[model samples]
Target: MRYDNFPDHSAALPEVTSTWSYHRRSSRRGAEEINDESAVSSEGEKEFLKVKKRKHKKIRATSQENHHWWYAFAVVTLLAVATRQVGLDLPAGTVWDEVHFGTFANHYINRTFYHDVHPPLGKMMVAGAAWLTGYQATFEFAVGKDYTPDINFVGMRGVSL
Candidate 1:
């Protein structure tokens, strides 16, 4: 008998149906496929986190570079000020172009007319500084001549710088 009239053919043929391994194998394969998909998604998340961390590290490095540049600028500025201030009062008098510029400054304070080869703005600055510092604008400027102790040429030079 073929058992075609049976209401449940699997129930009547339990041994043959139970021995069929295709259903179990298909179920196991489906479970493995789900696991593989989940593993791939987790790995992708890990990679994305790593990339984000790398970007953060780059930002930190850039910030550190900016700090370094600011520190360098500060150091250079301090060194320049120290260098410029060194021996500022040693000469105690006019040197180099001071003879020309200083005379022009004096003339400016006295309101006297003068002609200059260079622009007058620099002389005006010197004259303004001298006037602010209580200089009477009577100091004679000659090359290699020492300034009097009463004159605060250092203060004037500081203002010019």
Candidate 2:
């Protein structure tokens, strides 16, 4: 009875025997046998197919429910992105050193200013972004590319609202 003595060879037929297994064996064509003593399995193949399709299946929430969840998620994400961007943008124009540093950085890049009181790291960070986002960084920060400088207060409050 042990598989160690003889390999299961339904293939070779040299060691084939009349012995059979309790589990159903698929035919050479791979179709399973109809195990209906009441002649029901042969009656409706479509009925068997419908039952078989549902046998190992799981149910998920409908697309409408999923859509609601995703819609809420998208709204929340956009709100967060808008709020953070507005927070960074609320105070338009350069502050104290920023004005001088930004001007100095612009000049420095174009070979304009030397001799600094502080590090160029902060200026460099801002300058790098300005260079990337196109001209007009002298007014609004380079970070806000799509923003309107004229509607500063309204644009800022729009994101919060």
Candidate 3:
């Protein structure tokens, strides 16, 4: 059966512990984590809050510190160039396979060539390096000179490497 005048609805059951509103200063904050009324009364809760704030301060300090990555990048780039230069021209002197190829290259440049064993491309490649180095005396030196017994293992490898 229903009453006509503002049919009486049961009142909302009262909560045993009232919910509290927490003003979140940060958007990332979660819902009311502690019962505020009980939290303020305990000494342990105060110490907990202080510790949390100190950890947050440490995070802020690290975030605010300045760093220079460009200096690191510049140093690394310079080292790369130096390394390339050192390996580019080394031994100043004769090598093994360099002995063979360098000889053929010099021959072709002077038009006094041995019939190349491989393809025309092979002889052409040798002649190309001679042309690139401007038929320099060093090209002849690499082919003709007997090494003076230094580790100059790097001598011929220098041109290619």
Candidate 4:
């Protein structure tokens, strides 16, 4: 029976005779019921929960991977510092090109102009470090010569580190 002639309160009664006639009486309410039945079904609810758990697991794994990278970076930084700092002042004498650079640094301290193929910035830094360490530029810095007691050679090499 057509429910258009009945009052709105009458539509809420369970007197609806056929599925098609009941749906036509209240189309919006009928659609809501259909949707609720499908979504709240046991199988459908279980599948929804499974998908949510998978998404949460994937997000947790991604966060753990990010932490792994941070740990790796920290380890590498510590190793690099340890390798550079160990035996920094060993042998107690000039090694390699220190003979030439040390002479340039001495010239800078003594205010005497000297010619060298290298750029002046590096020589100036060494000179500044030597000055800060109270080195008097008295040592000749000759190859294979042992460092004097007052040269502050460790402080100068620390600048390179």
Candidate 5:
């Protein structure tokens, strides 16, 4: 049932006739308003609203930023190499537990069976270093004993670094 003489309040209140249409309360006027710009045709058909598109900004790194990264990398690499190489062979006969590792290396070089609590990779590396330096497994590697001139202790220790 449609009222032919319905109150002409369309200007003050929006005519909500479709389920798809909705109202939003305006902050300035404190009144409900239709957000979508919709229009009704003479046959009572509603037009679809147009959506706004958004724009995005692209970012790129400058040459100075890349140069700063390279400078930091070079400084770190120099410090690492310098720290490892400084005083690597100073008054070193058997520093710390080198006597045990040296004996293990000798065992590997002499092809003899010896048991160690640690893994064999480190001992094998030391043995390879000693073999490359022409070590004959002659030194006893006793604790606190000075390394002889015949032994290339620096080369053997270099394997660790």
Candidate 6:
């Protein structure tokens, strides 16, 4: 049945509860949740509210823990880099595979024509690094040979890393 008058409609509607207004205020103000509401009559509702509050607190705690993990990861990464740098240019010599690849890099710097079974991109990058380090590309990079102290092989190694 439809009510024609406003008074009849208003009288039929249930009274607004304090719980609803309290929740609204809590949402707006981030205030402490009110548990002493007379409107919450069911035990199940109170338990559900308690669970929800706990969930919110847990989410905040998890985010803080996640942030700490991110910082830990960063520190570990930095330590890894530092340790790797300790012996980055150790042995001071033409290491494994440098014979072929380093020759290719020298060829690129000298603009000399050479044939290789592999792609030339990695060699080109090494040659670019050599240019940055003022390497003359004239130094012979023989296999199983130690690099002389004069060459800036470390710079090339840095670029390779």
* Whole-model Cα lDDT of every candidate shown, in order: 0.71, 0.51, 0.52, 0.75, 0.72, 0.75
Worst 10 residues of 2 by lDDT: 15-24
Q: Which parts of model 6 are misplaced by more than 4 Å?
A: 1-66
Model 3, range 82-142, lDDT digits (tens) per residue?
A: 6766753344445445666667766766767387566666545655655664554244445
Candidate 1 lDDT over residue span 1-161, tens digit each = 87677586566764422212323433574543122223333555445445545665743466667799889999999999889888878777688878877788889889998776787787788888788878898889999999887778886787565
Clashes of each: 0, 1, 0, 0, 0, 1
- lDDT for model 6, please: 0.75
118: Cα error in model 3, Å: 2.3
- 104-154 per-residue lDDT for model 2 (tens digits): 546655665478788776667555555554434434334323444443333
| Tens-digit lDDT string for candidate 4 (39-136) | 34366544554554566574346776779988999999999877877886787989887887899999999999888886788878888999999999
- Measured against the true structure, the TM-scores of the candidates, in listed sequence, are 0.55, 0.31, 0.33, 0.51, 0.55, 0.53
Q: Which residue runs does candidate 2 get wrong by more than 4 Å?
A: 1-84, 136-161
Give the Å shift of residue 17 in candidate 3: 70
lDDT of 5 by residue, 20-91 (tens): 442232333666544444443223322322221112234668988879989999999999977877776886
lDDT of 3 at 109: 67
Better by TM-score, candidate 6 or 5: 5
TM value for model 3? 0.33
Clashing pairs in 5: none
Sort every candidate by lDDT, greatest first: 6, 4, 5, 1, 3, 2
Which pairs of residues clash in candidate 4, taking residues 3 or more apart in a chain or in different chains? none
lDDT score for candidate 1 against the true structure: 0.71
